[model samples]
Target: MSNFEFQLAYTVKPHKPERDETDAALTRQHLREKLGLDTVEHIETTLLGSITLNNSTLADRKREAEKLVHDYIHDALKELRVLSTVKFYGCLMVDGLGPAIRFDILPK
Candidate 1:
């Protein structure tokens, strides 16, 4: 079996309302500089998981990787109850024997 590493980043809806989009960054900075809370958006969440496939070919791996990512997106949409964009980054073999593949999948 071939082991794959996956990092999924997603931004969910119903994010805290700030004065504007810029305020999100300003708020984080203010908290970090003044209140010492280094937190960005309390809305976004990341899902990290790995998949072990029975195949070894790179072509097969790529197909499986994309399918896995789409599956995550579907789950997020259904369970999180929000539109989210999932980016698939740093897909690599667990044994560190080949080049890694990275890509992004935007929301529909």
Candidate 2:
């Protein structure tokens, strides 16, 4: 059988302050649309979301991005029926010049 399975959900965010439901809902929607799957897995948000600093350096940009990603995830957690334990692995920047901020999230 394929390794695909279910339990805790892992996802990423590509945008913030979505013009839709709370940021969290936006993240979940993005995942559902992309994966063509329907699920409501509750997970905690650990990336210091919405705490971005103003700067042009790579580090500053990464911090900004990660926070946004986690914020959306946080919102999604509220819509879930069964909540998973949340943990924060850390943050990383998107490859190349995009420097998209991504929060390292894990289901505990």
Question: Over the stretch 27-88, how does candidate 2's per-residue lDDT look in tens digits?
Answer: 44444554333444344322221233445775655555456455554555535421233333
Q: Candidate 1: where are CA atoms >4 Å away? A: 9-47, 84-108
Find the 10 residues in a row with the least total lDDT in model 2: 1-10
The RMSD (Cα, Å) of candidate 2 is: 14.0
Q: Which is the leading candidate under TM-score?
A: 1
User: Among these predicted structures, which one has the highest lDDT?
Assistant: 1
Name the weakest run of 10 consecutive residues (lDDT summed) in model 1.
85-94
Q: Each model's C-alpha lDDT?
A: 0.44, 0.40
Model 2 TM-score? 0.35
State, as a TM-score between 0 and 1, how close model 1 is to the true structure.
0.42
For residue 38, give model 1's deviation from the true position in Å. 19
RMSD of 1: 9.3
